[model samples]
Target: MMKTFLIYAYSAILVLGSLPQLRQAKKIPDQPFARKAKSIYRTPATVSRRVIEKTKSTVTVSGHEKIPDQPVLFVANHQGIFDILVLLAYLDKPIAFIAKREIKRIPIISKWMEQIKCVFIDRSNRRAAIKVIDDGVESIKAGQSMVIFPEGTRSKGTNVQPFKSGSLRLGTRAEVPIVPITINGTYKMLEEDGGRIKAADIELIVGDPIYPEQYQGIKHNQLASDIQEIIINSID
Candidate 1:
């Protein structure tokens, strides 16, 4: 327990220590360093894969061939923090995620996230969320694919929560293909019962990609519901 706590404590300190850099990145969104910092964390994120695999975790990936080399929007259900790591470890293509703004406060990981071109959204402010989407659309146009968790937060259970239509606007506005991903066992590995992180094998199932053009003009709620159905079916 001491060792585990120490690891987390160290990670926390590292994350907290990078605040100045993060603030700088926030101010100069276009600076190369803003995005470059995110790549540095890939080394640690890679090590994280070894840690998961060391615990005998099993990951089964499907429909990867469907991932077109041409950029598209990848959407998935968020169950735990491990979801990102699992996807990163399994997917060979270089992609970034749309994450919560708070994660940008973390130490070295924040820089890596920015460097990787991940878009961070501040959900509390509607205007900020819209601005973030505008930026995401620009990122897609620039040829970088993005992953978003429509659930908005970790579900921490088997039941699929109602998808938020607000978040779907990004994919549709960007006019990129939407890839629905189903991630199971992540919540189990990082249970909400307590703060403890457990080691467990997780399953990642990717479904057929949905083209945004097909859903053009569709109501946001309907679009979200459709995506949610597709993701849930992929899991089963």
Candidate 2:
């Protein structure tokens, strides 16, 4: 228990210590979008890698080759906090996420999230949610990849829930390919570990992209369900 607590402490220090650099990243004038994004994401990515290693988790990623070169929407399962960590540490692409609005209330952390182009939605407010999705579509149209957990929240276990089909509009409207992803065993790293870090064999599988063109005559909700099934089958 002491060792686990120490690891958490160390990670907190690393996060807090990086705030200065984060501020600098926010201030650089006239830098390219990608460069500024990398700056904003670098510290968090380092922290994610360290936390994963400290917990002794082993991540296996397959089918990432299916991801296209251009910005694509990653439709993935959410099992636990470790899901975010795994993606930040292992995925080859630079992408942002659509997160819940409450998280955006955090001061410095939220600043970093915004800088990295993360879109936060107020799910309770229908109009606001639509606006957020519209913004995400714009981001994708601007050549930036984005991730959305259509499950709306973490399942925290093995059973993947039915997706909220409306969320796939971000991909369809933006004309970006939707890459369905499956994540397994992340819940074991935290939720099933008695609320502490522990070694777990986690897997992330990236499935083939569903191009917007393929949905030319289909309903967006059907596209959402199809991708949801693909993700379910990809899980170990």
Candidate 3:
């Protein structure tokens, strides 16, 4: 539809326009790069907000104040592609994603993702997947907040899927708080309509932070299940 086409076209323009800022952000020294990268998030955030507005969609967020000041792992349900855009546009804190390796092949978008410290995982290869976890842990320890959809892929509906326990190691190894975020209704924006963009109201709920002390001794499978339940229960 025209609406969907315009959304993509405008987003392409926004990403292309941000090339200069991305170049400047890349110049920051490695030691302070993560700190400086937070500023760069504003560009993508603004772009995402504009894109969401282009679709005439609305996002209602709650419990945003629950996010801690320190870097934490954000584990959330993946409802649809719009889930990422919604988080980028609305979440107050700057965060990166534990994305699939295929996304790294994207042109300008992938470059921006790198600037934000997103870790790419190759789930097909066991060793590569382990290395991805190590990289994510290192990024978190370096002060970058990261997001992972334990479902591994979008469910394309409201039904919450079982989370893969291995992804929880990012928070465990980094010893940071694990925040459970529940994203509802994003699928209505695109996936529910079979890829057409539609006006939809979305809800994002930030659950209480599960700190290191609370989950320190818990098995990753148990933690993943507990977090999955928390997210599922928060959905409208």
The numbered model that scores best in lDDT is 3
| Best of the two (1, 3) by lDDT | 3
TM-score of each: 0.80, 0.92, 0.97
lDDT of 1 by residue, 127-152 (tens): 98888888888777766677888788
Off by over 4 Å in 3: none
Top-scoring candidate (TM-score): 3
**Candidate 2: Cα lDDT at 65:** 90
RMSD per prediction, one decimal?
Answer: 4.5, 1.8, 1.0
lDDT-better candidate, 2 vs 3: 3
The digit string of per-residue lDDT tens for model 2 on 46-94 reads 8788888888889999998999988889989899888987888888677
Off by over 4 Å in 1: 6-45
Task: Measure candidate 1: CA RMSD.
Answer: 4.5
Task: List the candidate 2 regions with Cα displacement exceeding 4 Å.
Answer: 1-4, 29-32
Rate residue 149 of model 3 by lDDT.
94
